[model samples]
Target: MSGASVLYDAPGPKTKARNRLYSIVGAVAVVALIAFVIERLGAKGQFKPEMWNIFNYADVRNNLRDGVLTTLEVFAVAAVLSLALGVLLAVARLSDHKPVRWLATGFVELFRAIPLLITIYVLWVILLANRDALGLSGNGPQFWALVVGLTAYNGSVQAEVLRAGIVAVPRGQAEAAYALGMRKTQVMTTVLIPQAVRAMLPTIISQLVVTLKDTSLGYIITFEELLYTARQMSTNIIVNGSDTYVPVIIVTGVIYVAMCLALSGLATWIERRGRRTKTGVAPATAAPAGDPATAADTGKDPAATP
Candidate 1:
């Protein structure tokens, strides 16, 4: 029987047949649903070669290339800043001093509680209003606003992830470090943080994916990111007597999926590497290979008996 059947009584032949029938029905339903969607899209000319031909235009290609570059730029900056801020916040929240802990907790709670869209919009407006004073120009307000908003929200979340990883460390490890006369800072920086990073690397990379997607929010502030470029192409570039909205959306979405999958693949590779490194060889046995009774009777170290 399958392991799932262990939770309850194994299905009898009749029940197994019924389950197979249900599975077949479900599969047919899914196939029919997909067929219907494809039929509708085909009728709407979404599958027409002309709709996809806009991608062949030089201007469209340039715009998309620039959009992808800008999106990656924002993601790179936000990712680095968020990670740094997260580390600082996590350390502060874990501080022994009550004031520092409370301050860090409040900051994380505040940012994490607010809607990310609202935060980005507010920052955009505020920065735009003071653009001249801040020496801001051409996309500066939009760029900084999006970057800072993402940093605040994601940093707060990353702080919690890191803190959880740190807390999950074996208590004995911390005690052992303390016994070695390491100060709290030394213990955390040298011991807890490194192990926590290894344990939490996957979660960290997942959050970075979230950060990448959230860069789309920059569209609202006119940041000229990927989605914004897609919108422009769909609206302005007419082909085959119709706007290329569907094709543009499909292409941009595939790009986003490709980037996210790349990140996930990197995370998986790193996790495997970490596991291999952590798997140490078994210690060489000092005990001799002999009958335990004989070794004990002769008062010889069982490990040393040949």
Candidate 2:
């Protein structure tokens, strides 16, 4: 017999033994599955030295580097645009006016319900048709289409996440701001939105990761982004009478994973900093000439500062 938590009862010795047995069995099964996969891959010559030799070439490395650069470019642009769009949509949805709220709701629902790939394809067609008028050249149309499409979908999701965070904030804070004669916009921008952003940052970063992966869809629009470049390389490059697709795919997948891990690590670092550092203005030092430094020490009274 052992201590039990509030939510669940503690397992007895027999139950713990059973659980350990199950875990061992599960681990063995997973190991066996991995071994089987490696054996199959070995039979297919996927790990052949010649397949990996292509990576040693300068052109191959440059092609992969270009792909990674393009992917990052799209992700950066889309992340900024999506966050901006989310802010606008969230504000609009929270608007006092019925028309504005309804319009924002419709826009969000429409984009959220539409498949992202379809959105990208449709936008690509429209952009391609008006390329000259839009001054789009080379991969510009595909780039914008993918970027805008990612913005639309991710923005809608981020809007919902932010809205939830905003609503989660204590209602009294907004009322206090209102009591202080602050306008709705000022209250929202200064008090509400900041709290909302801080609360929903993890969700926002997760969505940004999704946006990063979504860049791969640019291949459908003929955007020469990382995945597209890798695909082309795999199709063209031959080693020992076999297309070097496995190596290309493995390398491309690793790059994507690395990029995502880096983004997650960055978000984690930011979250940690946000925890360690205080928000808003730093505490004022002792009052000049001592008009009661008590208020200055506590940071409670603005009039106490010189």
Candidate 3:
């Protein structure tokens, strides 16, 4: 075939140069867009010191702290419960029993299908409906409503993450575990989960970030989270020369971004540490079997069954 017409030919130098030009143009466009946004917000007084100075007020400070605490409270509770529920749901989905699998499948699909805000609002209304009979008084109903809604929504998401993680683990691992006389449960808990968790740690953490953000939905029910406090402060404060609402909203968003970034960094650290371990265990493992060279360099024979 002629060089110009050959299907197997790599891109010509001219084509490669053109592609590079396109990439450069795209990058510049993105950078310009970001710069323009920053400039616009600055022009609107969002970045002004006077606007943020409201946060220095004692009332503002206390309200923000309380909001942060309330946010953390719901996040911690929902995270633990969601993780537990997710594990159970994941295991059930993988169960040999058809009924258990179907039930888990339905539960995961049902909650995940609904909007998170709707779920929280529905639970809040339900609690309000039977407050006396359920003995849920005062903030009890609201707190639990938020907690359960977050759990149901986030738990479904976590279940899908875990299921995908489990599937990503080499099938050979589960088979090997079975060959070693491990029951399904033992293989799953002891073998699959540890490794799958490491493999899917990022996704799990991402779902947790979603859960953290979803806590803002609690504001609709008057649960008083960080966003709620920000909105309240924005409404109550009238800075002499600034857009208080825009500034406060930006600050609140930045706080959420910072927290999520920290969590993501933690996940990245854990993942790297997991990679350095021997048996996919903790960082302090005595060996490094995962590294083929670690054994060879140390003059250890892996074939020796000691």
Candidate 4:
């Protein structure tokens, strides 16, 4: 009883034992259910292997590679534009001018409130109508419409993320910048924005992932993106007179997941590099003004002396 009391206070022992038992039971049940489902599905031919065989075809491979490239192109363009728009909108919303602030506020709210699918569809229709003036040809209209719609929606989300990041920073920092006679735009661009960017990098990266996934929505506008290529391939390649939809879908999904995972890996590397430095930029402290002694003296004590 004394040994048990020292290791796991009173009721803790029973609770711990119960939790372990429950975990083991849960794991076993999940494995059993999964095994049963897989066996049943396999027996019924629902898990056919040939559906995934389309990847071996040169045509399918070429089309999917093209689709992958197009998807990356659209995502890159939209992500950059969205980040730029978000920064501008965030600054505008924080503006002293009533009109500028109001306009920015309305724009962010309106787009954020609307579903991205509807926004893309509407833009597609609008672009199709004025295609000649916009120099639209080939996949240009669909691309631009997808880009613009994604920009608006993701921009709104990123504006809020930026605003939140800015607000999270110590108020003293902004006040200090202002006290130094920096103009509003200078303070925001040179100081606040950079710091906010570092602090909110994860959120920013997550929004980029959203933008990447949103590129699939381009299919609705007839854009020949990844999903469109998959659908086309499935339609053209019927295995034994049956649609090869499942195989193409699996391949396309794997492509998207791979791209996203790569982006995530890059973000992780950046984050690690940032942690090795200060503010994801230059070292916070510059080289000493002169001698090491003078530099140390000039720098305020990190801990308050009693």
Candidate 5:
């Protein structure tokens, strides 16, 4: 048996048999539940050819394509802005200055505590109300509202993640840097932040995935994103005397899953690349004050060196 089994006694034959039995029962129950759901959906004609055929329409396909593009645009802007804001907030929170740390803490806490949906909706309303004064037009209000709300909420979460990663670094590394006469800013930027980023990359990317998914909230403000477009298509399209809501929803949900998986894959690739790269500080060496080599380099004899 593996040493890890010391956490608990190894299972006896009877225990193993019971575990297998439980697993089989759970699997059977899950299969039965899925079968029941499929039967009901089929009865409702959701699996019919006509229901699934709506996606073949050029207009529907164009709407989905445009929706995906818009979603990607909002996600890209929000992800970049949020990461920048997160780094700033994290640095501020780590500052030796008390007021700056407190202000950063307050900002992070406030946004983290608020509901993201409400934040987005409120921003949308405010932007729409002041559209002319803000020089906003077209989908500008919806886009900005979604982007800013995502930035605020995800930025706070990422700040916490980065702070935790920084704190997790060994104190010895910072001490060594200081011993080399490095300033706090230099140590943080050159040593701490790089290590922290590598350690917290997975968490940062996960928050970004949440930001992408949250773009669906734009539907509430009529931003014409994937979810909003799906709703629009479902409502307007009739298939075999019924609405094509299920098929449209299924396709939209699949698209979301695909995008999130792609983000995860990208994060994994970056993590692998980081692991392959060299990290940490290189030690500095100094010659003894009276060494012959040092004295010769300085054009002075060692015996005559002060």
Candidate 6:
């Protein structure tokens, strides 16, 4: 029997009908809940056009712009650093040396076990304490704290992802590399790393999206990132005698969703490109026009015989 059949039998007609009905009922319930929320919000004047009008103000727009730029800056730096760190950690974890293996394992397990928020908070405190000694200026301390915390956590996760991919690679590939007189470092760098990255690209991008979203955590350290700026706008701005919290939240949420969607789209494009990439050994060079070994292999000169 197939594995799926062993797990559970295929649903009968009655069971399938029941499942369809359940899905319909669940969908109706969700729609009703959404309608109810809309009605309530409408009654409270939260859907008023004026609520969204705050974005028209130069100051509000500028704040949002700055917030977005800052968030992207942190994400870009953290993503690059995290990927780099992940590669090193993954290689070290797979090292023959017991010390290196143990160190990488402990580091990955330690950071991955700790909550990301706590890590960011602790780093912020430490950086703040020694800002002068580190030559941190302006938002330097907050920025580095958030970036480093993200790098540590996401890098650990990515290391495990890469390690899984590396392990999944056929053992023959490494054996072949060794047979060709490739050193361990050369085999890893030129052979293993590229394949592991290609195989694990989607998971890596997903982790990067998480890293992007987590930039919002910088707000806890009073960093004026997009989410932080949005929070301020939501609380401070008023429209029709109520704080513009709902509209601000909705707009901010939309922006965040758009960003994630864009990232996902970019990842999809890259994945498609990677799939289309030429791979495997190059086609053997055409036997130099009239080589005798080529003729012998073919039982005659291919050019003359065929």
lDDT of 5 at 177: 83
Best-performing candidate as measured by lDDT: 1
Under the 3 Å rule for N, CA and C atoms, how many clashes does model 1 have?
5
Q: Could you tell me which residue pairs clash in candidate 3?
A: none
Summarize candidate 2's per-residue lDDT along 106-180 as a digit string, tens digits. 999999999999999999999999999999998889999999999999999999989988999878778878988
Tell me how far candidate 6 lies from the true structure as C-alpha RMSD in angstroms: 6.6
| Model 1 regions lying over 4 Å from their true place | 1-20, 281-306
Query: Alpha-carbon error at 78 in model 4, in Å?
Result: 0.2
Each model's TM-score?
A: 0.85, 0.83, 0.75, 0.82, 0.82, 0.82
lDDT of 1 by residue, 1-306 (tens): 677868866779998999899999999999999999989999999998888777888998899899999999999999999999999999999999999999999999999999999999999999999999999999999999999999999999999999999999888778878988999999999989998998999899999999999999998988889999889879988777788888899899999999989988888888887766443211122245453433343454333322
Candidate 6 residue 53 C-alpha distance from true site, Å: 1.1
Q: How many Å off is the CA of 58 in candidate 4?
A: 0.8
| Candidate 3: regions farther than 4 A off | 1-50, 241-243, 278-306
lDDT of each: 0.89, 0.88, 0.84, 0.84, 0.88, 0.87
Question: Where is model 4 more than 4 Å wrong at Cα?
Answer: 1-24, 44-49, 279-306
> Best-fitting candidate, measured by TM-score?
1
Error of 3 at 291 (Å): 16
Candidate 5 Cα lDDT to native: 0.88
Clashes in model 6: which pairs? none
TM-score between model 3 and native: 0.75
What is the RMSD, in Å, between candidate 2 and the native fold over all Cα? 5.7
Candidate 2 local distance difference test against the native: 0.88
Residue 237 of model 5, lDDT score: 94
Q: What tens-digit string does per-residue lDDT give for candidate 3 at 1-306?
A: 566667545769998898799899999999999999989988877777787777778988788788888899999999999999999999899999999999999999999999888988889999999999999887888799999999998999899999999989877788878987999889999989997888888789878888888888888998778988888878878876443898778778888888888887887887777655534332223265664334443445343332
Backbone clash pairs for candidate 1 read: 287-303, 287-304, 288-303, 288-304, 288-305
